[model samples]
Target chain A: MADVIKTATRDAYGKALVELGGINDKVVVLDADLAAATKTGMFKKAFPERFFDSGIAEGNMMGVAAGLATTGYTVFASTFAMFAAGRAYEQVRNSIAYPNLNVKIGATHAGISVGEDGASHQCCEDIALMRAIPNMVIINPADDVEARAAVLAAAEYVGPVYMRFGRLAVPRIFDEDYKFEWGKAVVLSEGADVTICATGLMVKEAIEAKELLAAEGISAEIINVHTIKPLDKETILASAAKTGAIVTAEEHSIIGGLGSAVAEAVCESGKGVPVVRLGVNDEFGRSGPAVELLHIYGLDAQNIVAKAKQAISLK
Target chain B: MDAVIRKQLKIKACKARMGIIEGVFNAKSGHPGGSLSCADILTYLYFNHMNVDPQNPKDENRDRFVLSKGHAAPALYSVLALRGYFPVEELKTLRKSDSMLQGHPSVKYTPGVDMSTGSLGQGISAACGMALGAKLGGKSFRVFTVLGDGEIQEGQVWEAAMYASAKGLDNLVAVVDNNGLQIDGKISEVNSPYPIPEKFRAFGWNVIEIDAHSFDEIDAAFNAAAEFKGKPSVIIANSVKGKGVSFMEDQVSWHGSAPNAEQYEQAMSELQQALAELEA
Candidate 1:
């Protein structure tokens, strides 16, 4: 078998920024002294004049992005998710979202997958936070191709975009030519028994859970949700309507991420399907390997397989 | 400054102060003390310093100003109205539903508002970002921001101060309206960010101190800020809270309170008298 190709979303994000810098002179990258971690260092190397290091000040960096956007520049402010969504929530809300500025927040190192750095570094509620803010477009890409495309798409769309990325190296799920449609969900498989809605690295894990369910003679439809805010409700509700059962999976808190979004959409549409959310519960993550932490947080394929059965039974 | 220009500025400043009293009095809710305090400074910028055209408020090359101390929207609205960005009559609808002039400076709704600012400690950072944007674009547009003395208590202001200096944003100028009083009490008692000039200087800015109401001093400081190269500038403009109206001046009680009918009449009467004196 050919070796499975893998890449961290942060790597794709960094490379995509360099691409934007080359094609668009208005593209400016701002980092809060985390260019090395968030992978914006690539853009800094390619366009030194366009890159700004805000020096351990995430709030200021966000405000700077808002300011730059006012003057006709497209700014991507890159930082760890904890700082971008948690430490500077008001800045993002008041400065960027309130005015609806052309500022794209590249928040890398989200969810429990940020291992060893533990709870303080990991942000499990960024989607909930970003979603609550008006005019914020949240996108959590599933793979290398999708992540790269999402960055370019966000640059093209003139508004506030909160793009979540991860540090863990996950398997590439899409082809090199996969085009990322804005606010659209990708249907990976078809089934009748249950629908598995997953996002971020969990999408790769959901693909594995589909095989696991298949081995047990259960047909599972897999949908990859990259954009969480504008949330392709049409795709999710159609799948829910078909299967009559849904299992939402993510590497984030189940309360306000993909699971909550799917459940909300399903409930609001009167689908009456049993939606089982498989994600980190209301608890802080611990120090461990990224893979081990996901497993411990019940964000792995085995958990999704088990949850798929639960959804099927609930139906 | 020329003698004729000083007289014109004084007359406009009085009109701006009257507008502040009118807006707050009508709204029955808004910050008047701080707004009145910075009236002269704002009048100076709009009437004399800034390279902005009311006819072309959205012109790409126009100078920018962020009201970092955004509760002072009455003062800004009055200045904008006086500058012909909007009708002066629109000031009556401030803080009302459907009014474009919100209680805070909203860039989206208000014309000539360079940046949306209400959340304190964030606007100066935005101003810094605008300045940085100009430098990158190789544009000559300058960015100005006004922060309240009490507002500097926010930790984010220091973060912006640090970044503004580090970036060498020569086009950025931040003025701390050192009005002394906040809603709670005196800034010193509330939380002293005293010796404000030292802080900016420590952050590597070109620091200038001036009496906030002095047009000559205000003009000189703005000129110095523009001429200075390789660093941002911070002008600590020492000013009186509720500067024009005698009953409200230096009175912390008037910080966030709207005057009652009697007080409104008296305040407007006082400002009208001042405007008449300036004209005379």
Candidate 2:
């Protein structure tokens, strides 16, 4: 822990937009008056000519991003997950995804970890909402390194993409040398006792859970699912088959995030494995400290360890 | 206004109406009233205004048009065909599942369609983006988008309005097709966006008011919009809900309804007579 440096994924996203802007002059950034909060203000400062704020209108922001995509520009529309995915879902689906435009939705402050902002700002359902739209690639980066890479990958890839960034500063899991794969999962640590799959802020927790499970003599195979949509079927199914028991953890709702994606994949593959999903169960988050919310919502290491054991017992 | 140019545009506008009638009658489902209401303006843009090449539909330098009231996609498809982007015969396949022309304008499928729009209040925002895109690249291409009078009730339209001005999108031109009727009833009754010109002006736009069906007014308004600098422009085109076809004109029943065989015949005959009179 002493050796590891932690950086907020949103910080990485803002920096990545700046770095990408310099690399690709056609990359345009649009924010919905949440530039300071979403961290797109950094890009605005760097390239005043390229950044345009669409006031507080998330719907219009998305529509404008779609329009910009028609020209030779790759547009990134940034806002809170609640507004970007929840408020402007139709605009994203119709204007961007329907046209399959090159507009990247950089949604920050996702999940209950959005903390003191309470139930209104926390967006646990963004993954599900984005997944339902056709031609939309959903990426939830686990840490700062992956978040930066995800931004570049989303830009280079032509089409609409939704990337979720966390507000909390989590321990950096991967170094700067790590490669980001689209629609691919990274198997952090392999073991046969049970498969512990997690995403976003929960990915690091899964690693800690692996250590906790190791102390209890349970060898948990940890998998970091960065790209939730297009599900990386091969990686997930193979891990499920190998482990025979699975547990999924995310800072989102248990209903329709990484857990749901993994469950559907395992079920569809005809591999009858026991899966225990660890997340907020059909409830809204309240105003609390960021870390307390994770623990209370069952989004921490102890819960992942507990769920991993439960999955193994069910199998 | 040059009488010869007006006569030629009238002929094209008549052909455009006939195509719209053919498309809706064939599809058995499409918005004919709004489509017909916009035919003259659509004709004016494609035939005489927009710098677009039929052979190069995706040409980045070409001026762009986004039909914000995209239920009027029939009119756009017709104008695109009249402009030789596709065959006029394909207008019959307007809303068929296999057709490239969609229920709404799809920028991906349709050859000359600039932006995809169906959900109301989105097209104008996209138009703003196009204007911003051109300004970013220091390009000369302009963007035009058409909106329904009723569609202005959407809060997003105003958001886009203020944004276009805030960003100083001078290359953008938006037309509110104030035919006075939405699907429900007259726009005045259905949450009025009336005094549309002053609203746009308040949003820092160069506002122009015109009779949408008149070629001279349409020409003058679009030309003024083009010449205006340092701010975006909005043309409030007062129009008949259903223009050209006598029975459907000003009739709210025709708002989203496609005409039956007899109605289609009468509409086409009326447009054919108008075309003949213009030629004579």
Candidate 3:
């Protein structure tokens, strides 16, 4: 394996916001009293005038982002994923998504990786909630390189976007030269026996799971799906057609995260591939060390390997 | 305010009310009560106060307005049409399947709409954002928003209020149409956001109270808002639930119900008479 580089996606997001601020004078950042936590404080340090602290008002911050977008500004509103996507769901839907404004919602601390804060702070349903809104683009980047690139892509896009980031530092799967594409899945490896589609922090786990499967004489394809909303149906369907079996993994709930998105895509394409979803089953995340929580909730690489074997058996 | 200008504004207000009636009557559904109540305020803002051009609706320098109480879109649509944003004939297509005039204000569909608003308590926050954006961009444009009396019951409104004040958004002005009614009943009974002015004052805003139907007070309030510096302003315009038609005035039943054929005729007749008197 290439020398692993560990960094939180939120760190990349903060650095990206500062870079965007320098490049685009119209870029503005708004935070709801979580500037230091969400990492928008980096942008705040670089450009104090453009950063707006909404003072613990997530819903108002969303409306402000929508309002700023109307005036030709690319507004980045940051907060915890639980608050940005869950608490302010209606504001995001009505104010940002409904208008199709040029607002990028940079939601950090997503999924079970938001350890110690427990289920109240961890957001597993943001992707599902955001996907339901029309004109909303959902992006969940896996590593530092992808997170930074996704921020730039979201800034250039002329509509509302929801970008999810995690709290814990994870293994960097992509190098600095990696380019992020919207609505296009990046195939990490090619195999015909089965496919493992993953997103966000789970992409690293899927990579680890592929090696484990290979050791058992099973070949597995690894596809990193960064954009969940405008799902790369063509790539996903082609992979499903070739592999004829799928194991979807994520650090979110099994009900409505990347797993659900992949299953829906396969079903909609009428590809009869049996998809074994590996994620936190219908349960809330508990307070523990992030890695331990992932293991307890069955969201680790071993879980993905098990699901891949199950999918192969079903096939 | 000059008598001639007041007379013209009254005429425009009457015409705007007529458009509201035309829209709701044709659609067979809409919130006419709140729309009629804020007709005078909308007329004053578009025709007299705001520096907006119908031909250049998307001009970056133009003043922005957000109808925070978006159910009152009929009032905004009527004013925009009268201001030549689109044809007055388009008012009849409101709430239709493919019409640009949606059930709420949509910036994408409607011209002269600064921000798309329908869900209560959100528009003011966007207005704050616009005001802050103007400050950040060093633009001279100002932003204005209108909210309903009952709509202020939303917690988000207070959150936005705190933000506007904390940000010292003097370029932003919020007008609350204190019509005293919502869909259920009187605002007091539904959930009283009473003492509106004091509440805004508590939030560090320069509060201005006015009779929303009076063009003189509406004009003066806006001017006062423009003059205030270092803090946001709120104009609490006390108004009737339904102002123009006699039968509908202050009637909570008219909150979201459209006028029937007989009721529509009565409303049009009343508005036309008012317009004729103003012209005289």
Candidate 4:
């Protein structure tokens, strides 16, 4: 197995989609003219016949994807997070989600990682939008390995799914041996002080926070909740029960995001764990470098450590 | 057309309209105006035109029908129920919890529903895809979709229209239910989709215009579209918002507002007379 390092989930998604297309002839890709940015150009090059470039019409592409899904084709609709979840939300909700089609929406450029494109392109609110739609399996892989697993999982899972990936490459966190499972939380490390439940890019951040907390003698449990919907309820409940405190971190809005999903699961399970959701505080991100944006939004490991300390202090 | 079958279709259309009336009136919630307006077209499609068997709703080679203007689901539900997709008794379950007949067409719940629809301007795209699928599979099945004239304001419809034309989807025929009313007011007042036939023609479709309510015109239009080869077709059916009900006819307020008990009785009486005249 290759040494585990943090890599962008988008790259992993690109690689996995190409692999999935290799085996499954029914697998087709439709991009809204963002093949290069969305990292689906590789698939387009391989399968010219199956690849459809709808030329920047996100809504039309979404409808086309839904149309294709109805015909017994496994359709992967790719676009930027804003266009995929924001621009074509109605299409996703009605056309694909409503019918429960086998459509995989690969939404990239999520969060402030889409720097220089500014606020319009950066989709901090995508998770909220997709999570609100019923029957949509929202998965944000923590790293490249998880992203590959997510792509395979979505291919195997028979329904509409929203797989969000960030464009910026971070540290590769998972080894080649790491397996991906939908709706399951992987506990990277377990501790009794507090559970640091995180998703997407923040999983890496939480891991680092755990390392930092170790030096301070605060044993924090680090959980990578890659799947946002069908949230790993057992893992969450067990972790909450053991730790008695929780903090959810994500590169998204604190509202209706990873934190909110975690809160809902915990509330339903009747767990009274105090949770501090660490994310953007109802503000649009500014144009900056990816690391800068993460720090500015209080989504870095330092912030996670601070929140975990605060959450643990209460209990 | 056989005289007996034509008479049966007329009877079916009357029953479909009654189903729409009763379904909507009971729900106290539905698009009665558009439902009534498109009743004849749906009746013609389900009863006379398509190769769908109620016993085998999910038949692989079955003709696919998509109601793009999904607010008109009451009409579709009525037609499907009367056609034996399910019991006519289920008509009362429209929009109710655990009912297959949702506010809009739901393939998940409804037996005969091919595609779930509520969002305007999407079903056409799905229909196009089905036609493409049929072509790819070397199947001879045809796909039909109905869109409200007002619903075409959504640019996605045009996108699907262009895709269908570009693909030369001959097996696909779209019916533009040209009732001028939308939710707020007249479609012209909202966003005029004037010259709908010309618009479709310009988009590389074989265009036909007809009085949507008249079975002769609808049958002729379908036959003509079926006969044409190499290109997709669009039949722009000129329809009133509320076609048969005297008080509700041409009324924009009926777009989603259901008829009360009195109005429902009156509408039923009018449709009964029409059915009697056709029967006679």
Best by lDDT: 1
For model 4, the stretches where C-alpha displacement exceeds 4 angstroms are A1-7, A267-271, B1-5
- RMSD of each predicted structure: 0.9, 1.1, 1.1, 2.3
Per-residue lDDT for B21-118 in model 2, tens only?
99999999899999999999999999999999999998989999999999999999999999999999999998888998888999778999988898
Q: Write the per-residue lDDT of candidate 1 for residues A1-315, one digit (tens) a residue.
A: 899888999999999999999999999999999999999999999999999999999999999999999999999999999999999999999999999999999999999989999999999999989999989999999988999999999999999999999999989989999988999999999998999999999998999999999999999999999999999999999998899999999888988888898889999997689999998999999899998998888888999999999999998
lDDT of 3 by residue, A1-315 (tens): 556789999999999999999999989999999999999999999999889899989999999999898889999999999999999999999999988899999999999989898989888888878888999899999999999999999999999999999989988888799988878999999999999999999999998888998999989999999999898989988999999999988877788778888888889886679999987788888899888898899888898889898999998
TM-score of chain A of each: 0.99, 0.99, 0.98, 0.97
Q: What value does the lDDT take at residue A126 in candidate 3? A: 86
Residue B93, model 4: Cα distance from true site in angstroms: 3.5
lDDT of 4 by residue, A101-185 (tens): 8999999999988877789888999999999999999999888877898899899999999999998987778877888876889
Model 4 chain A poorest 10 in a row by lDDT: A2-11
Model 2 agreement with the true structure over A1-315: per-residue lDDT tens digits:
277888999999999999999999999999988899899999999999899988889999999999888988999999999999999999999999999999999999999988998999998999989999999999999889999999999999999999999899988999899998778899998998999889898889999998999999999898899998878989888988998999999888888888898888888889779989998899899999999988888889998888888899999
Model 1 Cα displacement at A188 (Å)?
0.7
Per-residue lDDT tens digits for candidate 3, residues B1-280, read 9999999998988999999999999999999999999999999999998889999988999999999999999999999999999999999999999999999999889988888889889999899989988998899999989999999999999999999989899999999999888888887787787878889999999999999988888988999889999999999999998899999999999999999999999889988988888887
lDDT, candidates in the order shown: 0.93, 0.92, 0.92, 0.88
lDDT by residue (B26-109, candidate 1, tens digit) is: 899999999999999999999999999999999999999999999999999999999999999999999998999999999889
Error of 2 at B144 (Å): 0.5
